[model samples]
Target: MPTQGWSELGGRLRAMREAAGVSLNAMAAKTHYSKPYLSQLERGIRAAGSDHVTAYSRALNVAADALSGPSQDPLRVAHEWLVADTPVALHREAGRRVGESLVDELERRVIELRLLDDTIGGGDLIPLVRRELADTAEVVKCGSYTEPVGRRLRIVVGELAQLVGWVASDAGNYLEAERTYLDGVSAAQEAGDSALAGQLLSSLAYQMSDVGNPADAALLAKSAVAGARTASPVVRTLLLERVAWANARSRDREATRRALDAVDDAYEERSPGIAEPHWVYWMSRDEIDVMAGRCLIEMGDPVSAAPLLTAAIDGYDADHAREVALYQTWLAESYARAGELDAARGVIERARSAAADVNSVRLIRRVEAIRRLVS
Candidate 1:
């Protein structure tokens, strides 16, 4: 114990325990370790017994080595969690009658969290949303539930995973987002939920399109359309919109125009009052218009994009701090394209103000883009 400096290990243990929402007194009670000992252990002054390592791990609800080991790589931990097999007993025990009400509650929570993502940028919400994804996955993994309930829970998990992935993308965790999206896609397919899988694929395409992988974006977007071929009119239209944007990102003007026309036609067929997928509840004429404007701006047709971007900004809700900032940047770009430098400056300033309210990685990048334009 003296050979190892306890500071780092102690810090890790303390942080993990705190992150797990366990207090010293509660941990002491659960681990049957004294509170003073626990406190000193965290301060790197006291050496814990070998038995205490397992006890602490249990009390903290983590792997024993997470506390006992000197160098536990977080990525390794995540990989292990992802690829490790669930215990046979746990899987079988899950058949004991998971309630429908639990599934309903999780579904409601997913909807609320999606709204949170819309209102608040991912920078401030990634960790929280990741925790939500973990909790839902935990329920599916450990809860005793009937087959029907299990299926419903799996579907909810897929949706949450996709949402988490999107939040990660918004927060600039591109690799993490991709991994989360793949996990969600697998869960959705396992549950026979094509629509959710398609939405997630589209999200991946959207991320790729913005992050400078237009070729990959185009492929994924097309796959999303294919996957959701039987989805509602609104859903297909939204996927097609992504396809348009992807093509635009790649500077394929003709393909972009074709996809855009398809989007418009599908939009016209969308019935206003029918039940649509909850994942796309926020989509509307306004959202479509913004995407259209973004595609035009990317395709060097800012003249056509300017009015549409302005209209979206005018109608965008205040709670969407990041998108409001981002959209304004797009409008500013459009103005600059037409030699309206003064108008561009005015719009960029307003965008700067909105950007102050958001904590998004994407918003910051756009802010920089606007700055470069004016400079």
Candidate 2:
């Protein structure tokens, strides 16, 4: 059933695709939508729904809300407005006390955005995340609150900055990511949270390693570890792994090995009753093994890397398509480096299949690089 605005939405979609110089067939391939189905939608014979809008957003590199014009669903309308430039009423009202409840809502929204990042590309999430960060920061700057609530709000700002930074990095906006991370570090410092500040620095370090600044990355990673000495063991373990990666990128095998050993040692210090940070939930044995394998691959020990990558990939949830594709590419690369050409071809094919529908630019670029290496 086509909505009244379907024709207008269809026109915008067609115009956007043309302006981007993307052919209809190319759009179909990128979106995984049938050519006829897309044509029908573009012709206004079919309605543009949420799934369709998301698909188009990823393929066209636009925000999902931009394509979902004048949505009828109340929830969709609310979300669209959330990501829009509409001013917050609380911020407009002078002398409004910022309460714990509002801070709690902001925290909840930040967590939801983080979870959203796991499944969607940074391209699709950038607008929503940027809006959330801006709104939160404005609230902190404009609204009145006690010192305690102020500290919590700043912490939320730090969390949002971390997310926005990571999302920017994923979208290949290195400079934006760097600036956002530094802002987050400042927020964490204001909140007197060394651990969160360290996390921000380590994230920037990871980005540096990815973008060919391994030596700088090594310094930043070590600094992150030093600054967060009082953080939980798991958090320290995660930071140590970043150190290993930076060293591996630098081709300092001895330094890389030492940092990996430290990772294991820190993880061993975990106690049963100590409260774990919510952000460290994804730091686990499997993640550690995957990082170790990736470091080994970086250090030119493909034979050693293969088994670890295989095991981690085997245990990984397939629903996390971007991660699965990323791991598969590394596994494929390891096989190729080991001269297991047949295995490399097979794994790369699987990687390609897994990444076909995942919208992460990083994963797509990785899969292409592995494809080139294997071929």
Candidate 3:
């Protein structure tokens, strides 16, 4: 049989390494593969076997599958694919096609994992999703592509950064989340995607609010709204709502009212031509009602907040245990603030039950806080 296209494989691997920003010397040192051997492999003078593939994959923080072969015997497939005598362009195109397909599948999986986390709660599942995201990032970074391919790679990178930020946020690693969100913002800007940048800024603002920096959060939210001016109406409305929440946190009643009014205006004027980002798909009117109620509660207007919170809790899907728990906790607190002791107790019980279902420490803490408020 003809020797496989080792030269093409070698070139692709070299390109991948460069795209990943890993120096050959650095990879060699990390993998203990020796600089000369790595050079031979990259030049197509020597085929990289499974061992070498694994070592290099580990060094580059990528999935071994990219270097190895097909899922069944990826290392063998990789070696064969590299040395095939067809045009280098053809091989490169094949790799690009494969990478795009994988990226799309990985994106769907990531979204599914996120939805599951909301339903089943966030523990081991988060790390698993992070690992998968990292793998997808590696694939995008490694695969050869034209200019359009590079754009897709940048998009994937930005999305991976966002997912990393959310995972860190769920883990209570707020500082790490902030760093990841910053990375995402840079990637989005580099991709020349203002809508993605706006979403990243909104997420960053939420992270800031989580850390109790309402002023900074409000500023960021406002910046997001301004940046997303040309974005879809739904996106603009979402950003405005976030700004309103931040204003509520900062006790800027007039600003909060203005932001809320903007949200209403945007919603009323929403056109079928406008499209929301996938991440904001769950943000419906009921969710907005919950958000507004929470703002009211923070503003010490429990009488005005109670009904909205109750409506949100009632509207929330029971399958989303963690969110249900959070909404229930908010409801309980609202009832307590309104001095409805009996109703507060019942809501607290539901909150505790939902908290148990999710096993979320944060939700448990909220439940405790609600109980204290009622007591």
Q: RMSD for each model, in Å, please?
A: 16.9, 14.3, 18.1
Q: For candidate 3, lDDT tens digit of each residue in 206-229?
A: 877757699999999999988877
Total backbone clashes of model 3?
10
Scored by CA lDDT, what does every candidate get? 0.77, 0.81, 0.68
Worst 10 residues of 2 by lDDT: 69-78
Residue 228 displacement in candidate 1 (angstroms): 1.3
Better-scoring candidate (TM-score), 2 or 3: 2
| Deviation (Å) of 119 in candidate 2 | 1.3
Q: In terms of TM-score, how similar is model 2 to the real structure?
A: 0.76
> On residues 1-375, what C-alpha lDDT tens digit does candidate 2 reach at each position?
112244567777888888889999999889866777788778865544444666688898897666655434323433564655533355455445778777766665665566556566676677788888888888788777899999999998899899999988888888999999999999999999999999999999999999958999999999999999899999899899999999999999999999999999999887533545557756668889999999999999999999999998897645466777888888999999999989998999998887777656788888889889978
Candidate 1 root-mean-square deviation in Å: 16.9
lDDT of 1 by residue, 138-163 (tens): 87777777888888888988998888
Q: List the residue pairs that clash in candidate 1.
A: 97-145, 98-144, 98-145, 98-146
- In terms of lDDT, which candidate is strongest? 2
Instruction: Give the residue spans of candidate 2 off by over 4 A.
Output: 1-95
TM-score of model 3 relative to the true fold?
0.70
